[model samples]
Target chain A: MADTVLEVRDLSLEYRSRRGPVKALRNVSFDLYKGETLALIGESGCGKSTMGFALIRLTPGTAKITNGNVTFVDGPNRINLMEMSENEIRRFRWTDMAMMLQAALNAYNPLIRIQDHFIDTAKAHGLNNKSEIIARARRLLTGVQLDADRVLPAYPHELSGGMRQRVLLALGLLMQPKIIILDEPTTALDILTQRSIIELLRKLKDEFNFTMIFISHDLSLAAELADRVATMYAGQIVELTDVFSAFEKPRHPYTFGLTRAVPTLHGAVEKLESIPGSPPDLVFMPSGCKFHPRCPFATDKCKEVEPKLTAYGGHQVACHNWQQVLEESQKAR
Target chain B: MALLELKHITKQFRQGKKVVTAVDDVNLAIQDKEIICLVGESGCGKTTTGKMAAGLLDQTSGQILFEGKDISKLSGPEFMAYRRSVQMVHQDPFSSLNPVRTIYQTISAPLLYHKFAKDERDARRRSIEILEMVDLTPAEEILDKFPHQLSGGQRQRVSVARALTVNPKFIVADEAVSMVDVSIRASLLNMLRRLNQELGVSFLFITHDLALAKYFAWEGRVGVMYTGRMVELSRSPSLIEKPLHPYTAALMSAIPEADPRLTRSKERIVLRSDDIPSLTKLPPGCHFHPRCPVWLEGKCDKVQPILTEMGPGHQVACHVAFDITGGGSKISAGTR
Candidate 1:
């Protein structure tokens, strides 16, 4: 897709807690093209947030980026994020890429005025013209449908949760980064607020044409927003495919279980089929195929042997029996 | 028989000298086998009403009748027994289930406490059976596992199993599926529907997601709440297809359709006010008048609107039901 903007290859993350090393991510690979949203979706502890944090090197002191490479192909520079020095990453971060973290309320400085926070971010990046920066900030705020006057002068506490989120979005867009990563940006908002925020993101993306790496636990929201969907389970991407294909024909059993679990807006009342077991503890993960314990379709081979992600018809699935699962799911329907 | 009936039930909590009326006078009925959905925003009082139904909180006035008996009068063991019959499945499965306890121990505790089984062995057996009913097969393996060992979805299943262990006739699932991932939410919902059909367990499925509610309940009645008041209640399909209340119509429009092709042109109803009016200092007359889109001037501020029947079984509490003056257009109940 026109020289992939960001490429994540075989990314692995580990954390050394008091208990021991917790393997949070394993061989995670994906590519973000310009002007597209790639949704990384899974349950709470499925390492989705871990991946986002790892990308920005925001993981806690206990955590470490153990393996893999993240390559950012900017205009003239092809930078390997992992290999780059701290100073290099600092320069690359706001200019080439930026992140909109979860917990928008806590992300900003409570002591500072909302507009000052934007000014600080812009100034640090060497965009010193106050009027130019202010104008840009106002335009970005307007892009998210927030009144600049009302929001700019107000303190963080004065603004609502949704407005704070819009401010975060505007701040993320201030640098005009090629790639923007959002980690569950709407998780804390109410349903209506989430709807508006998501709608705003969609509209902003269309207007700005920036590549987005959207990470969330809400599969339904992801299915709606993402061009391609990736389902993560215990440190690995289990299924990756186009949104329509993933929903219509999910190959991975874990993905199937996830889809079956989500309650739809309009349909007959149906029982949510839950995965049989919990996620494996990352500190001492299961021997092979972390999902084996919960998988209804798991066999002796599944427990004894780990499966590699295999590509077929533009979909990548890490399951021993994707063919059988696809057939069985079809038959059930 | 209807397992529980909430007749104009309201609750007001006293904070210092101020009184915060959390639940406004609202009417609802829970039949023996029907899953009634109470959908609304955060401060809508669905949880307060559920707590009242479970006898966890005392209603300010009005009646909370269980099996035609007023539960407010029930005391001590009688109240405890009433609590046993109405089980609440909370939003966070992880926090709800004790982390240190085994699945069997957690599930069997209720059965043992209520003296449902003769002995510990029987309780264990019954617990396993309930687990199996929720599709946690090879129940023996799951029995010994602690809450931390279970996945979010599995933990939620254990929560359901524990609730069912008491063999409650009515279950109040307050955002039961909200915390879990969407892929597994449908399956859990399907299991609940099965319990309703097979065991005749009535459910009060409370959530903010109207779409999820529509998919999980049958012959279901939907109540829309706004600012601690039951704004609208109607048959599920009717509520979705033709929402009578302006609030309900606005909420329906807010839902992002999964199919982007089905584009709706409805103007997004962004509530102008940031904070909900503290119940302690609520506006006069209609509680929702301050925030309502269709609110009229003196009519909404001076007079409280009773929930009048708009059609067969359809009820709405709004002073400007027929006004349709504000928000730039009129939304007739017939068009909804």
Candidate 2:
């Protein structure tokens, strides 16, 4: 809650489709504090990944940012990322803000050795010294608990999925960016491997103190790593609160449903109720609230008029029936 | 009597020259209307075991007995009967359902082939009934829709309905609900649970998730797999509460639950190594010994341990778990 590193305001994006423009992001607004991890949790097609791409201006050609701005702050310098020219933004990226895309194992060139990747990244960022790049890469790879000697000369395909993910993580931190956006970092990993990655991430965060935007659908990842949590549904931030508040006292019905839907590894066995229906179609979204059709507490107002995010107690929630949801959650407890 | 029994089943695949032992002498006996979940990481042979159990894949050795009859020895109608009685619902609903076929066609094919339906008219009626069984409302409308038109959850439900068309006595669902969204996963699981109870169909639910395995098999049993071997088997609650095998304990400890305070505060059982041993060149003795925290170096790395009964309905394949010597003390000291 101190020193805002990144401020995203009214960010909207749409993808060109034959049916129409698919509104992927709608009025997404959040502030990422320095040295804190903000997890953006959502199901597929909820624009969580899109928001990560939009933050670094790395979305596909079909996607167009319709409105809004991202302000990157570093000490006395404050720059609007959206207003920067293509070359300026290109230079600004990786050096100031880095993004580790989902399934980054495939992002590497299969022909090149791991060392070449570090060299290429360093050269792109204007760090030309070969010895310096190798030294930095060695430090990062060792820090991630990998043997740099074995990993450096091997191709991406030679490494296992977990090792490849760690290589990517090490590569992402090479430039020492102030902000790191990791998209589904531990997805597709085994339970033990995921735990190791989570532990490594926590250790790295503590050591580096870099602001992080962790995007994942797995609630466990958020519970373990996030300082703050954002629940995204239908291209909108439905809820934003501290990690403890979001899990223990969720204001939004979607968040509550998500928490209840997942069967925890421990604790008393309880009946879990899945939310009815699927995610809304992006091109032809439902009227009013996008989640109303599936919400158990939906009413006429919810079906007709969408609710804006309103501060309640200590967190922000975009729901017409937060009080009722709170009451229901408390009653269950 | 056991509905389906897999006795010392071993499946091997030839990757060019080297033989990959996918499933290594895994033994299991599934009771009538029982739910047994096989859980492990990728390439741990859970899927291969499921495929063998479903009668789709032939094991290199060992016997699969359906109703106490050797499935491999069955001929003509007997083989056909075994095939029809055991069905498989795959992990991906998108690819599993034929894109060209409508829900009605997919459902009716199995019914007509198996002679479960009297005529086309009867097949249509039965199709609707089966669709409704999976909670797909207005079965009439859903029957006309193609796989691409339905959501992931809906397509999965349609796949289940198709599997149910044959009236299978046993079902092998391999990561059945993993592809669907988290919010709809419980509904799919609940539907499966209901079918198991109401239809009296036994299930071999295979998944990588320990939590899902525990939830779905709470009343039945859970088996833990590592490198093509069954390392541990027990009732769900006891298995979760007190995992016997070091691998199972590591898996149980590694899982981060969907709770803030609990997950953060929970102690992790760190493995000695993170890499899973390759099936082609597996370690000499216990495949898990390389990564196991409580592994006895001289004993575990030399002689492979078989499933040894620890208690009532509980079995673990680890020398340290039984502790012929002082291995239990090392387990307590190494993990925390």
Candidate 3:
């Protein structure tokens, strides 16, 4: 509904393995709207993190983007990231977009003070005035509810896990980028710490109005943060819809199964039904639908024909038997 | 009689010059086929308590009784028997399984050592039976594969199978399913529940996830720990619904539910501080007092509170909770 800030068209990537190419992403297409949080939710090895890395063109050496066009649009200027030179992309990275990686402890150098990380990032983005950089970093540290005085001078190991995560968040916002991608930011933190971080993110989003792509396996975080959710399974976008529709009326069976698998903290304890099988191997994938091996409503057609992501009403789902899935999900409620 | 019991369990570790009390004055008794989940944040001593229960680590001051005999005082054969009856399933399936050993070699070693199987042929048969019991299908195919060949869930099942090799009466599963995928977690928990039901093996399950604790130990009991103390212990469903301790209530209110509407609308208990204090420099009196929302100034900071019975089968350790719950009728008598 809002302005489209980034468009990914037919994006596909693969990892060069000893056996063969591991198809990590397959024909994934999506539009990221300005000032909206789009959550990429999936289990492990579902290419959610790969999608993040691919967006910034910072994928590992073994990863090769085979086919894709990533266009970044701001006002009248349209720039295809795939066409950018290595030097140009480096200059465009922190100023236009930034990615906060997982495990903040590992993100920072153990020997350096927190201020150095901020200063180095700012300098790389061509901001050489040391005092100005320190002032901005202090402001962000305080904005994240950390004591700027104590945190700015301490090493990464000296700070707690939650504090380190907050520092990383502050550093991501140091250049004041319009788009930020966070990968499993709160995975290992305590519940109270997670709540505080969620609250802080909400506050930051309201104040800054920056577009965010949150990558996490935790469904509750996605439910609390995202405007729209894309369920990734076996290196493909299986379902894409509004957060409400994604949870209340998930059309794809894998999305439905994921919503049912997690137990809620406050609710009637119902018998949870887990997805029947494990995720498919990326190198030697099964034919037809990637999720067909675990789908209860899978038919003979599903085994032979690959279903494309088709729009029905307002949402998109890649499933042949979605009507039956909708009916059964409604009945379960 | 209880199958296993830990009385006044206290574990202290010497780190450089300072002595860190990892677990302090904890008491628990698990009966036959009972499931008691210990839920807490990291550095809260849940794992240390579990290791003590499994006899993997010795408690500095405590009594671990297996079949009414103290484990520390047991003779060589008696200690071996105690070790056989109690097993541990660690958190990381990747590192817990020996990388070099094949699945058959790892599982059969315990069977042959404890003489659960008569010979090598018998050991192979028993290993397959145990692997099949944990639902690792095509057991014959899996036996020859090394740990790296299996998925995380498969490796965890192998771990469970290895724990089951000795036919343990009590298994201490410390965050057993945390490392697996969300879809796989439920099935693994279901398999563990099935083991509890069919084999009559009790468990001391440990995890930081309250939702998972509620799901796994719904029919059993849940214990809430903070720092190195047991703050609350009660039946699972009630403990989740009507938590008495402030820490437990804070954790319950703070956790985000999977539902969109429920998670957003739920009220939260904001703590005084977010940082969990270090073990070496723990605050005096109650370990949670510094961050407690309902802390008493003079009493809570001056005196530690022991577990007191608030209602039927419910135990809480807090001065404010004790006051709010009518000051209790009796102190917990060290038996669940």
As a TM-score, model 2 comes out at: 0.98
Per residue, candidate 3 scores C-alpha lDDT tens digits across A214-314 of 99999999899889999999899999999988999989999999988998878778877788888999999989998899999999998889899888986
| Candidate 1 stretches greater than 4 Å from native | A17-20, A127-136, A267-272, A281-307, A310-313, A319-333, B14-18, B75-77, B98-113, B117-146, B257-304, B318-336
Cα RMSD (Å) per model? 4.0, 1.4, 3.3
DockQ of each: 0.42, 0.87, 0.82
In candidate 3 the C-alpha lDDT for residue A103 amounts to 82
Q: Flag regions of model 2 displaced more than 4 Å.
A: B324-334
TM-score of each: 0.86, 0.98, 0.97
What is the two-chain DockQ of model 1? 0.42
Indicate the DockQ of the complex predicted as candidate 2. Answer: 0.87
Q: For model 1, give the interface RMSD.
A: 3.2
Candidate 1 structure quality by residue, lDDT tens digits, B1-336? 568999988898888988887888888888888888998888778889888877777888999888888887876887787788898888899799888889888988888888987799998888888899998878999999999877777888898888888788999998998887665666788888889899999999998888887877647888888778888887887777667676777677667644323323334665544345666677888777776666788898898887877767777777666454331135433132
Relative to the unseen true structure, what is the C-alpha lDDT of residue B72 in candidate 1, on a scale of 0 to 100?
72
Query: What is the Å distance of residue B114 in model 1 from its true position?
Result: 3.9
